[model samples]
Target chain A: MLHIVNKSPAERNALESCLRVAQGGAILLIEDGVYAATRGNAAENHLRDALSRFKVYALAPDLEARGMGDRVMEGVATVDYGGFVDLVAEHKNCQSWL
Target chain B: MSEGTIKKFMFVNRKAPYGTIYALESLEVVLITAAFDQDVSLVFLDDGVFQLKKGQQTKGIENKNFSPTYRALDGYDIEKLYVEAESLAARGLTEDDLLVDVTVMSRAELGKLMDEMDVVLSF
Candidate 1:
């Protein structure tokens, strides 16, 4: 499976590009990318439109660092670093965009 | 910067190529990592998108334009190239105008992709 990694403000753009081929891939937001959990970012709407079936995840550390833990969008699950390691084990390949 | 059987590596490039040497430095690391026979991929987003634009005039910046170096990425076996779809459109660019061929995707899809990585490095 293809894993999409978002790491910066441009993550919204990166995420959009990966979703074009996300028919069977998953998306995760980490580091500065967690800002998308806040309201008003076009990223939320893009997710609703492109990855209706894939699970959405955010790095817990990044979310807290941005002070957005409470503001995380609905349906977005929080995962810790260990959980992140689990994901890498599950998927054989990944693609990351900053 | 990874251990174990980390066969696949993903590079999240977020900064512009010229302002700092981060992009160039990362490229060197990537090439060395690939020398270990690891699978490598790169996603250009934010300022990183500016790295691939054609006709970069870095002379006034007193820096060498490394755009040509990208053309050689394939030679290093690091060719899973990608770009942010919205970013390209936001900057009024298309794959045709880029120095490389990249697969574009939506934001949500990119998130999922980042989760399934054996190794991830950001620059």
Candidate 2:
């Protein structure tokens, strides 16, 4: 399964809610949701914990747009738009945590 | 626009850049306001503070890196940039991480400053 989250954890609970229910799948963080994958953010610990259960990915463009491309935490992979499409196609099932 | 017509304009940015259009839209509007010689001040809080962080490279995302425009604000006479102390701390960022020179104030102090604005716009 692939879980997509686009909202900021500081501003919304979409990421938190997704983490609670999602099990053993890949999580792609895009848009404001990319904030969760950065270093020093309050949600860093939660994302770190989720890493054990899922392969977390963040949109490269979104992180760069926020000027945080270099600050992404360790263990999380970054993907471009093409990679995003691939993730959607690779997964038999996907969920967007809008 | 006469000298007496200049108004205090405050643009409150709460969204992270590029997550949505809010941050960019607010910046554009702020530039437009500066052209009118309005007394413009930008307040960055919450994720909005991320807009001011340095080293924003957007080539990979293929979006115009608008973060550089923030540095150009001073040339436009838009120099009053305020950041919330709590917001930076929450994100583990300090003033050193910001691209522009701004006054960092507590939320309470910011609120009082906001009260003095003739107009306040939230993004």
What are the RMSD figures for all models against the true structure?
5.4, 14.8
lDDT per residue, candidate 1, B1-112, as tens digits? 5455556677878787877888999888888988888888887766778888888788897888878888898888777887878777878888788877778876556656
lDDT for A78 in candidate 2 is 100
User: Candidate 1 lDDT, tens digit per residue, A1-98?
Assistant: 54546545443455654555455555677887777655566677766564466777788888888778877777777889997877767777655554
For all candidates, state DockQ relative to the true structure.
0.18, 0.02
Q: Show the lowest summed lDDT stretch of 10 residues, model 1 chain B.
A: B1-10
Quote the positional error of residue A66 for candidate 2 in Å: 35
Candidate 2, residues B1-123: lDDT per residue as tens digits?
365698888887867887798889889999999999899999887778999999999888888889989999999999899998978998999999999899998766775675466766767
lDDT (Cα, tens digit) per residue for candidate 2, span A1-98: 67788999998967875675445679999999999999999999999998998899999999999999999999999999999999989875565655
**Which 10 consecutive positions of candidate 2 chain B have the poorest summed lDDT?**
B111-120
Best by DockQ: 1
TM-scores, all candidates, are 0.60, 0.56
